[model samples]
Target: MKQQDNRALGAWSRSSTAVLAAVAIALFGAAAWHLGTVALSVAPPNTLSRHYPRWIADHIHPELEQNWKLFAPDPPQGNGQIEARVRTVNGTGARHTAGWTDLSASDIAAVRSNLLPSRTDQDLLLYAWDYYALWHDQLPGHPREARLMAANLKRTALQRLMPQYQGQRITGLQFRFRFDRVPPPSWASPTTTDRPVNQVLPWWRVQNKDCQGL
Candidate 1:
C-alpha cells in the first residue's frame, strides 16, 4: 500500500508539472505575438507590414492605433490654437459682441497642474477642431459634417461662457485660429523671425435650441 501511494503521488506531481509548463508556454507565445504586432504597427513600412496591411490594421486600429506625428523625420513645427467670441442679445434687444476668449488656453492650463488630466481637458477641443478641419474645406464650402462640426465647436464655447452671459441669449459665435511657428535654434538660424499667423472665421448664427440647457 505504501509503494502504491508513493507511485500515485509521483504521477500527480508529474501531471501538475506538465500542466504548468503548457500554461507557461501558451502565455509566452501570446505575449510574443502581442509585442510583435505592436512593433509592426509602429515601425516604418516593412515587407511584412506591406504584405499584410489589412491584418495589421485589424489588430491595431481604433484603439491601439499609433500616431508618429510628433516624432521622427517630419514633426510638427508649430502649435495651432482656436479662440472664439460670442454675440449676445440682451433683454432689451441690444446686441453685444464679447471680447475674444482663448479656449485652448484653458485646456492647456488644466493639463499643466494636474498629474492625471481628464481627456476632456486634454483632447476635447483639440480633437473637435481636428475633426472639423478634416471634414471641411476653406470658408464658403459645404462638406459632410462641416456644419455639424462647426456647431459642435460653438456649443462647447457657449457652454464655457454661459455663466458669464446669464440672462442674455447667445446669438452668434465666431472662431479664429492662430498658428505659432517655433523659431529655429539660435545656433542654427539666428536671423530667423517666427511670427504667429491668424485666420478669423465668419460669424455663425446660433439657434435657440442649441443654446438650451447651457
Candidate 2:
C-alpha cells in the first residue's frame, strides 16, 4: 500500500508541472500578440503589414494610431502664435472688431506648471497647427490634405475660444498662425540675423448654422 501511494504522488507532481508549462505558454502567446499589434501600428508599412491590413484596421487605425515625427526633418527654430480676431455685430447692428485674442499663450500657460505633465494635452494643438502649415501649399501638391489640416486647426481653436463669446454676437472670425525660426548657437556672435517669417492664414467666416462645416 505504501509503494502504491508513492507512485501516485510522483504522477501528481508531473501533472502539476505540465499544467504550469501550458499556462506559461498561453501567457507568453497573449503577450506576443499584443506586442505584434503595437509593432505593426508604429512601424513603416511592409509586406507583412500589407498582408494583415484587416488586423491593423481592427486594432490600430489612424484615429487610434500615433506617429513619432511631429516636429521632424528639422524642428521649428522660432516661436509660434495663433491669434484670433472676432468681429461682432453689437447692439446697433454694426460690425466692429473686438480686438485680437492670443489663443496660443493661453495654451502654453496652462501646461507650464503641473504635477502630472502630459505631452498630448500640451502639444496636440501646437502640432496640429504645425501640421497644417507644412501641408498648406508649402509643398504645393496636396490641396485636400491642406484643407483637412486647416479644418482640424480651426476646430481645435474654436473649441478653445467658444466659451469667451458667450454674450457677443460674433459675426466673423479669423485665425492667423505664426512660426518663427530660431538662430543657431554662435559663441562669438549670439544674435540672429534672420527676421521672423509670418504665414498669415486666410480669414474664415464663421457660421452658426454650421460651425463644424466651417
Candidate 3:
C-alpha cells in the first residue's frame, strides 16, 4: 500500500509538471505574438508592414498603438493646454458663466510629485482632447466628435468644480486652447521670441442627459 501511494504521488507530480510546461509555452507564445504585432504596427512603412496592415492594426490599435514622436526627432515643440467653463442656469432661470477652469493644469498638478499617479489624471483628458482634435478641425465642425468630447469635459467639470456651481444647472460648456511655442536658446537665436496663442471655441450646449450620472 505504501509503494502504491508513492507511485500515485509520482504520477501526479509528472502530470502537474507537464501542465505547467504547457501553460508556460502558451503564455510565451502569446507574448511573442503580441510583441511581434506591436513591432510590425509601429515599424516604418515596409513591404511586410504594409502587407499586414489590417492584422497589425487589429492587434495594436487604440490600446497598444505606439507613438514614436514622443521621443526625439520631432517631439512637441509647443505646449498646449485646454481650459473649460460652464454656462449655468440658476434655479430661478438666470443664466451665468462660471470662471475658466484650467483642466490641463489640474491634470499636471495631480501628476506632479506623485509616485503612482492615476491613469485618469495622466491620460483621460489628454487622449480625449487629442482624439477630439484629430477628428475636428475648427469650431462647429464634426458634431459627433465634438458632442462626445463635450460630454466628457462636462462630466469632468461636474466632478471637479461642482461645489462652485451649487444650485445652478449646467447648460452649456466652452473650451479654449492655450499654446506656447518653446523659444530657442539665446545662444541659438538671440533675437528669437515666443508668444502664447489662445483659441477660444464657441460654447457647446449641454443637455441634462450629458451630465446624467455626473
Candidate 4:
C-alpha cells in the first residue's frame, strides 16, 4: 500500500510540472508574436515587411494627419495689413460710419517690446492677413475658399475689438488689405521690384450668423 501511495504522488507531481511548462511556453510564444508584429508595423516603407506597416500607418498616422513644410525653408517675403470699417445703427435708424481701423497695427502693438507674449502676433496673426489677401485674389473662382478666409478674419477681429463696440449696434462691416511684395534680390532680373498691391474686399453686412454675437 505504501509503494502504491508513492507512485500516485509521483504521477501527480509530473502532471503539475507538465502543465506549468506548457503555460510558460504559450506565454513566450504570444510575447514573441506581439513583438514581431509591432516591429513590422514600424518598419520603413521600402522593406519587405512594410506591407503591414503602411496599412497600419494609414489607419493611424495618415498622409494628411499633419502639415509638413520643407525643412529650413526661407520665410515669406511679403507684408500684408488688414483694415476694417463699420457702420453702427442706433435708435430711430440713425447710421454712423466708423473710420477704418488698422487691425494689423493693433496686433503689432500687442506683441511689441514684450518678451513673454507669444510670436502669434508677429507671425500667425500677421500671416493670417496675408492668407486673407491671397484668397481675395482668387475671387469668385474659389468662392468657398474665399468665404472661409473671410470668416477667419472676421472671427479674429471680433475677438480683438469686441470690447470697443460693445455698447454700439454695428449694422455692417467692410474689410480691405494692403500687401507689399518684397523686391527680388539685387542680382535678380529687373522685372520684379517692390510692388505695392492694395486689395479692398467687398463690404459684408454684419449678419447674426457671421459672428458669435453682434
lDDT leader = 1
Q: What is the lDDT of residue 165 in candidate 3?
A: 82
List candidate 3 stretches off by more than 4 Å: 51-55, 58-76, 79-81, 89-99, 102-128, 134-159, 167-172, 183-214
Per-candidate clashes, comma-separated = 0, 2, 0, 0
Best by TM-score: 4
Look at candidate 1 and tell me the lDDT of residue 120: 72
Ranking by lDDT: 1, 3, 2, 4
Model 4, 1-214: lDDT tens digits are: 9999999999999999999999999999978766665555555555546445444433332222223245556676677777888878777677888888988888778777677778665675565565566666643455555676677777666666556776666667787878788877789886755678787767777766766653
TM values, all candidates: 0.56, 0.58, 0.57, 0.58
Residue 50 CA displacement from its true place in model 1, Å: 21
User: What RMSD value applies to candidate 3?
Assistant: 6.1
Which runs in model 2 stand beyond 4 Å of their true positions? 1-75, 90-94, 187-193, 209-214
Residue-by-residue lDDT tens digits, candidate 3, 3-104: 999999999999999999999999999999898898887777899887876677556644576876667556556788888898999888899988899888
List runs of model 1 lying over 4 Å from the truth: 1-76, 138-142, 184-195
Query: Who is ahead in TM-score, 1 or 4?
Result: 4
For residues 156-184, what per-residue lDDT tens digits would candidate 2 score against the true structure? 77777767766666666677767676777
lDDT of 1: 0.78
lDDT of each: 0.78, 0.72, 0.76, 0.68
How far residue 174's Cα lies from its native spot in candidate 4, in Å, is 1.2
Candidate 4 to truth, TM: 0.58
